[model samples]
Structure formats: structure tokens, C-alpha cells
Target: MLSRREIESYESQGYLHIPAVFTGRDICEMERDHEFMTRHWASSGQGWTGPWRKEYMDAATEKQSQLVAMHDLHFYAASWMQAVTHPRLVEAMGDLLGPNVELHHSTMHTKPPETGHPFPMHQDWAFYQHQDGRYVDVLVHLDDTRHENGEIRFLAGSHAQGALEHITCTPEGPCTPHLPTANYHLKETIPVPARRGDVVCFNIFTVHGSYVNRTSQPRRLVRLGYRDPENPQLGGQSHGRPGLMVRGHRPNPGGLHPAYSSEVGALDAFKAVPEPALVG
Candidate 1:
């Protein structure tokens, strides 16, 4: 699904954006699924557990709006499972992570108008450190994202240098690695503004973050993570939830944790269906 130039760009620059890989129909289904999940969560009246969930829920409730984001939706929603396992995405992941790639996890980020939160600059590797930096994240845009609406900004070629020391601000908030704002050689960051159905793939160590949404419209997107089966978690620390093998066979017996078949049963339909031609 990726050309030599595109692959090289990802390798050399730490990221690549592919426009219109998904069709309009796909985005519509995703938007619908997101709405259904938001309503279900709200109606259930479940208390938020983790820091991220708590912050998201609190902000949404205060604003009388939808949840800002949710993680591991693929485990519950069939639409999300299909989107995460889409052939084009899986194929593109294979280009980076080799044939035997596993789904690390997936998250749907809904930045509602005006009150959307800002993510401080950080590398994903800080959260999930691997022996080899082989993990890649694909961000699928469901809405047209611009600088005014919290488009992601990435530091070019930062992935090749490896992980940096991170600082913890609050016990309840996210711990992000700090970079000197001044004298940092890679001062000029690239802003990624994408349209609906576009996707951006970035390395795990890539320095990236987004600002608050200033627009009235919501900025929506789904992030899917892929990694090689051979890359085991260091010290048995959990990154997110258990992952499913979306492409190729897993050669390592103890690589991935075992989970209930029902958790990923939704992906069966995608595997059975014939692959579609690449969309431009």
C-alpha cells in the first residue's frame, strides 16, 4: 500500500501521511459507531477509572458534550474492529513492522469544539518501551483536521536518536518526556493537517503532540498501533490491553498475551472478505 518513496520517508523522517486511504462510506460508519459508543457510555453512568478517562469524562460532562476520547474500542465495537483491521492499513503496517504484525491497541480521540484538551509534546515510547523501536502508530482522521482544530505536530527525524528522559508533572496526569524549547536542533516542527479519510503513520519514538481545538466543530480521529510479535514488553509491564493478530501468523508462542476469542471475533468478517483495491 506504500510506495518506496513513502516507505523511505517514514524511515528517514519518522512519519508519513497518506491522504484518502479510507472512503467516505468508511468515515460515515466510524462516525456513527463513535456516536453510539458515546451515548452508551453516558447512559451507563459508569464511573471513570484511569486518569485519561477521568479527565475526558469530567470535561465532557462539564461541557454537556460527548466523551473526548476512548481506548480499546476495537475489543467492543465491530465497526472499530473492521476499521483497525482494514486491509490497506494492515498492508501499510506490514511494510513497517514486517509481515507478522499485531494490533497493540486502538483509541478514538474526539476533540469537541472549544474545550478540547491539549496533549503536551511527548514520545509514545515513554508509555510503552520495547526492546527494539519497531512499534508504529497510525492516526486515521474522521474529520478535517487543521491547525485551528488541534492538528498533530511532529519533530522531524527525532525517532532515530532513541528515547529521552521524561518528567512527571502530576501523579494523576500523564508523564511526558521534556525537551528543551531552546537550542533544540530540530526546532522547526512539522504540522500535519489532514482531511477526512486521511491517515498519518509515525514511529513510536517520534516526538508529537497536538494543541487545543479552537474551532466550533469537533476534531475526530482514531489511532491504531502495530508492532512486531517478536518485540516483547520489557519487565512484563502492560501498555494497554491484550492485542489481536491482524496480519500474518505469530511465530513467537509467548509473544502476545492470551485473550477471549469473543474479544476479537468481530475481526473474522474482515479477514473473510476479499481485499479491496487501494484508494487514492
Candidate 2:
């Protein structure tokens, strides 16, 4: 569990970098599972392809840059299923998001050696919109991260400003939302270099991004989104889907979610039951 001072710091700074939260054994198991996922799963390029990316990376680096990513590790790997619900992480989540902490989602992000992709400055809110800033993104580092290896950078106390307007990439085929390159510069943000087993936690509203990895080694990290169950998600990623409880019991059980619709596409989510609770 985090100290009261640490929790206060996170409340004030809008982010907290916790070092060596996972043990060597834990990392080894996760690493092995990640390797297996790389081989079995259909990982794809999830790099941000917008004009904002150009401002963060050079033309040559941009061409070579690629991000290997996949969502929801729990479905495939038991090791990760256990890792996401690790006691230490759950305790931290409880500390940040109150007693009842529910997992919104998790994703594996592996930046390949010497040309890893870059992300533009933006809030996770554009992807998953919650009514409040209670959602926390916990980044579990499986490998050491440095400036040369695309360490995540955050604008200090930017979460205090709440969600900002994210623009779509016009020329780019898919609309990847990001803040304007003119205002949110990479140089102005603070880089957070972390070691293997370290976990960084920050509010979803916080503005953050990363650069291309220049090292010969891969930078692996798993992002787990945990939030207060009562946060009431509006839309975006994991919309209307039920979340796994990692800490205390969920508030107001057996209720309708906003993502539910009469459309057949929402059938599974609509039929989901609260009895077989996924308690972490």
C-alpha cells in the first residue's frame, strides 16, 4: 500500500512513479507470457500516425518506427491474469481510486529495438471517457525504460485542467486523436525513465506521450486501467463493458451500463451477469 504522503503527492502532482513494485519472479513469469503472446497473438501496429507524431520524431525515425500492441492479456495468459490482480497493484489502486477499484482494461505495448514508435501528447479520456478523473492508468514496466527507449513523458499537473479537445489526423487514414503539436511540445514535458518491475500511475486525464526507442533492446510495458466503480464511464474504449474488481466490492451492483443499446452488437455485454464476479 502507498503511504499517505505518496497518495497525497499523486493527488497533487497528478502522477506517481513507484519503483520496483513487482518482484523478479513476477517479471520473469510476465516476460515469458509476453514472449508467448508475441508468437501466438496477432499483434498489430498501434503507433500514432498524425502530424503530431512528426513533431515528436524525425522523418527517418518516423518511417522505421513501429509499435507492437494488443489489448486484454487476461484472456490468453494466466500469468498476466494473475499479474494484473497482483496484491501490491491492487493496494495501490485502492489507495488512488478509493476502496472499490475495478479494472477498465489492460494492454501489452512492446516497443521494438531501434525504431520503436512514438505517441502524441493526449489524454486517455479521448479513448475512454469517464464522468470524473478517478480512472488511473497503471503502467507496469517489464523492461528498463530510458529516453533512448521511448520512456513515457507527462505534462506536470496537467490532469488538473481536465480533458482537453483532441483533434483527428486528417491526412492519416484512421482518426487517431491527439492534442495540437503547436501547444504540447515534447521538450516541455517531463520524461520518466523507469527500471524493470517499476509501475507508473497517473490519472487518465493527464497529458502524456513517448518517443521512438533508439536502443538495441525492446521496451515492454503493460498498461492496466483501474478506476472507481462509480466513476460512470460515458464512452470510448471498454464502453459499456463490465470491469473486473481488483480491490473492494463494486458500488451499486446489478445496474444498467451506458454502453448498452438495443443493437445486436451489444448482446454479449447486455447479457453479462454480476453473479460470477471476476474478483481480483
lDDT (CA) per prediction:
0.72, 0.85
Q: Write the per-residue lDDT of candidate 2 for residues 13-84, one digit (tens) a residue.
A: 788999988887878988898999987993757476677766766788777788888899887899888988
Best by TM-score: 2
Q: Name the runs in model 1 displaced over 4 angstroms.
A: 42-67, 169-187, 235-242, 253-280
lDDT of 1 by residue, 28-132 (tens): 887788788766742321212233333323566434433366677777678788888888888999988888889988876777777565555667777677777
Q: In candidate 2, which residue pairs clash?
A: none
- Judged by lDDT against the true structure, how good is candidate 1? 0.72
Model 1: how far residue 37 lies from native, Å: 1.4
Clash count, one per candidate: 0, 0
